[model samples]
Target: MFRFFLLSIVCLITIPGFAQFPESKPEDEPFLDIGVALRFNYNLSTWKEDQLERGGDFGFDIFRINVLAAYKGIKLNAEYRHYAEGFGGGMLKQGWFQYDFSEASQIQVGLNQVPFGIQQYNSNNWFFNMTYYVGFEDDHDMGIKYIRDTGRWKWQAAYYKSAEDLVFSAAEGSPDRYSYDILGRNKENNQLDFKVVRRLGDSLAHELGISTQGGLLYNLDTEENGTRYAGAIHYEYKTGHSLWNIKLQAMFYRINPEYAPGNNLNFVEMGAYGANYNVANKGEIYTAGIAYHIPLETRLLQGITLYNNYGYYNKRVSGFENSHMNVLGALWTAGPMYIYTDAAFGYNQPWLGPEWENAFTAGTPGDTDWHMRFNINLGYYF
Candidate 1:
């Protein structure tokens, strides 16, 4: 399917007559923006012994290249990234084309971000909220979406072939990078998602919306249906460079497996904080965060922002304990470079990483019940 999508995109770009887009202005040149981001990171504490053994303490975060081109009302965008290890040598993070039907409406196709959680997370933390690990925020999939804004309201809806392909592919002996599947009980299935938002007022505005997903997931030879529901609210107060924002969201899911011999349980892999922690029959997830941006008057910096996020995972299955995760971070924007530093802490958060869980459960009196990470990320964006 990935190959087919690539081929279709190539055909669209290379087709003799179709390549000519209608010009919005005959005399104006097409607009293009190219950007590159280099990340340098340091891990003060990995919170896992195995990560240290694997030399994961410090390294380059990623080498990213981005391109955006627009002619008339037609636009093309792509982002490619190179990781240090595991996953794959590199992958396409986003590649999509957008055609505007009007000033406030557009159609997008290709691999793009799924519109589930906050439009663009308002968190100043580098890692974003925990919902990200569970595929709620910043998750991208190959699909087509229609989006529109009508001054006071916004609408988005999409259908995806699968959650995503290459990003979920396993590396070496480890499991897939992400544990949960939006497809639910079927190995391959389609998912429909819709979101509608209404905004109130201008300054000190209120934004509320709801979104849902229905699909299938697979287990062995049998497939099952799975469904999810979620709702979100965001509040913002902005006056000049000083801004305050808050976000709240909740999600619940259930899986119904087909009755197959030897298949007794409907399973869903729950991932947290970038780790596949446990499997459950059903679960509820709650997430919230607040951010404040303080404009700076210094000669070298544009702003200093602070943010905090909290997440709770409640598993309904027995023998599974709930987990909590949080992050307090700050960002300093100086010219084209941004410096981010944060302290992440988690409790009973097996999603912190498998190796960390093993160390915590090893019964050593010295093992800490909570995990902590002191992280710093330096990104130069152009």
Candidate 2:
């Protein structure tokens, strides 16, 4: 199934004359735009413990296919993704249609991203970090949302299903009664989002956003329901030669643990703060990163990008005390192409036992505890 969809997209982009599609002019063209991007990365590694060893050559990954089209009163947009190794497998990230009813109001319907967090609104290329924060998964639900613009103050409202999956049930009384069949249901997970922004002065601006969602769930053994909520606030400042932005976000959920049957979890949460600065013509970018695990009460540098960067992560947290990491790399961009390289060394500090001494390492086996990565990306706009 995934393979078929992947092939269809390839054909759509590669067929002869596909590029000749009507191009709108600046003066006479409607407000529509389309673009695509391709990105790839490779890595080398060395490890201190058997548990941390895994490396080899990876294939090019199709980052995304972004499409934007809008007419006088209607708008359409979509994005898709393709993974490495799965040449014929891909997934639809977004597909939506929107309508503008005057300069102040608009409505959108289809499978689209939920407008709940600052990261969702900021373009991927615009962020200082290339990776998403913990708990910030990229999954969109089918739904509808409305937007209204009132000068510097804009607002949005959204409602969507929480889950989009099929459950299998056993057929009643038959030799193959134990066999299960797939069933689909529209769980009532819904969300509401609101936002407002205003410029404080010539070089300062602030924005506030709030979002909430709730819905039903089906437990494997029995039917169940639950609710989840998330909220975020952001502040941005830009001057002739400096820029600063900060955001705080949180999420809460009430549910049951699949493995720990009969154990109902009340809350699980995570938070992160990041800031970056570009010194006027210093020929480099500087960034600071930090994240807190409410569930584990642990914190770390996360990363820093000066010119270029290299960093490490625990990948997973169990009874681990302190995870190790290293950062060494830089980035350069020209025209529509960007290139970057980084290497790092990581050591795991266990809360108990022999500390796993150098539990994780990268780059060279003994020379330097770091692994090197090279990334090259090219994108075009129309």
What TM-score does each of the candidates earn? 0.78, 0.55
Q: What's the lDDT for candidate 1?
A: 0.60
Q: Please list the residue runs of candidate 1 whose C-alpha ends up more than 4 Å from where it truly belongs after superposition.
A: 1-28, 49-56, 166-188, 223-242, 257-260, 263-266, 270-279, 351-368
Cα lDDT tens digits, model 1, 220-246, are: 344343444444444433333337767
Most lDDT-accurate candidate: 1
Whole-model Cα lDDT per candidate? 0.60, 0.37
Q: How many residue pairs clash in each candidate?
A: 8, 11
Scored against the true structure, residue 160 in model 2 reaches a CA lDDT of 68
The 10 consecutive residues of candidate 2 with the worst lDDT sum are 276-285
Candidate 2 at 299: error in angstroms?
42
